[model samples]
Every structure is written in C-alpha cells, then in structure tokens.
Target: MDGQRDEGYVVVVNSEEQYSVWPQGRELPAGWRETGERGSRESCLAHIDEVWTDMRPLTLRREMADGTGR
Candidate 1:
C-alpha cells in the first residue's frame, strides 16, 4: 500500500455531520456512521464534496438556527 490511493472506500458521517472517507473493511471510529456510499477513495471524496457544503459543526448549526451560536 503506497498510501496514495485506496481501492475500497466508504463515505462516513459523524454526529456533527462532518464527512470523511474510511477504508471499506475497517471499523468506523465512534461517533461516525457510514452513509452507504461505497466505492473508490476518489468517488467517496467526491461524494463528500458534493454533500458537505457547510463546514460548520452540528452544534453551531443548531445554535445558529436558535440564534445563539455567536
């Protein structure tokens, strides 16, 4: 493994809604949920780019909605 690329990947999301790519067969760390998108690393990264437009934390988003996150 050169670490430059991976053949199998899965898109994962955490409780905070952040996105990341994980190796396909590895166990996801706590707080992350697999989003059901599985493919190559590039595709998984592309999926994250497509969906994760807002980089704010989930707590921040909730607070902003309630007008308190300043």
Candidate 2:
C-alpha cells in the first residue's frame, strides 16, 4: 500500500455515527458523508479518534440504553 502521508483523506460519518477516513476528492460510499474535515490520512484518523469515542453503532447504543441489547 502507498504511504498515507502522500494522499489526502476526509473524515466521513454514516447514519450510525461511525467515523472513517475516505480518500479526498473521491466519491464517498453510499450512506457515508464527509464531515468537512480534510487533510492527511493521519489527521483524518485523528479526527475520528477524537470524535468516535463510542465504538458501538447508533442502533446498538440506543438498544442498550433502552435495555434491549445483550
């Protein structure tokens, strides 16, 4: 794989509030949208790490909160 430092990336989030880094200037995958934060892959990952403190998906979190999840 190419060095991530050479490529640009953007922070993206889905309905589940999960965050990820997508290639800058590339079309985002279905159900994911850019968070308007763009930079080196490391920066994007840092952004996700800072914001995505909870690893669980939105639905699972909700279920847990409602006492429905395992």
Candidate 3:
C-alpha cells in the first residue's frame, strides 16, 4: 500500500474467506476482491476482527474436517 492517508482504505476477501484491509482504489491482489467496504484502516480492521472470527482459511477447515490437518 502507498501508506499515504489520502489512499483511504477498503476491506477485501479471498476465496478462502480471509479478510484484509487494502489501499482504497488500488489494484487488488490475486485471489482477493473488494467487499464494497470503505473506511479508515482502523475501522476496516475492526470489521475484519468482528466478522472474521474464524481465522482459519477454508482449505484448513476442510483439511481439519477430513482429519488431514496438522
């Protein structure tokens, strides 16, 4: 991210259900897309904290369920 305040921020999510904060209006990284969420980094982080209680990615969850997780 540019780290400049003018960039603002947005929340992003990937197929694995991971949540992250990214620079607003910036190009998104692979496998992650915008969630239509825009705000300060702190607010976005707080949203992630609240909604992303299960930090494990979807693959990990499937692995654990299949008894193949470490």
Instruction: Estimate TM-scores for all models.
Output: 0.88, 0.87, 0.81
Task: For candidate 1, write residues 7-65 as lDDT tens digits.
Answer: 68899999999999998878889999999998888989998999999999899999999
Q: Model 2 residue 14 lDDT? A: 99
* Better TM-score candidate (1, 2): 1
Counted clashes in each candidate structure: 0, 0, 0
- Model 2, C-alpha of 9: deviation from truth (Å): 1.0
lDDT score, candidate 1: 0.90
Clashing pairs in 2: none
Question: Residue pairs in steric clash, candidate 3?
Answer: none
Indicate the worst ten consecutive residues by lDDT in candidate 2: 1-10
Better of 1 and 3 by TM-score: 1
Q: Which candidate achieves the best TM-score against the true structure?
A: 1
Residue-level lDDT for 58 in candidate 1: 92
Rank the candidate models, highest TM-score first.
Answer: 1, 2, 3
What's the distance in Å from true for residue 56, model 2? 0.5
Q: Write the per-residue lDDT of candidate 3 for residues 1-70, one digit (tens) a residue.
A: 4555843999999999999999887799889999887888888898898899898999999999999999
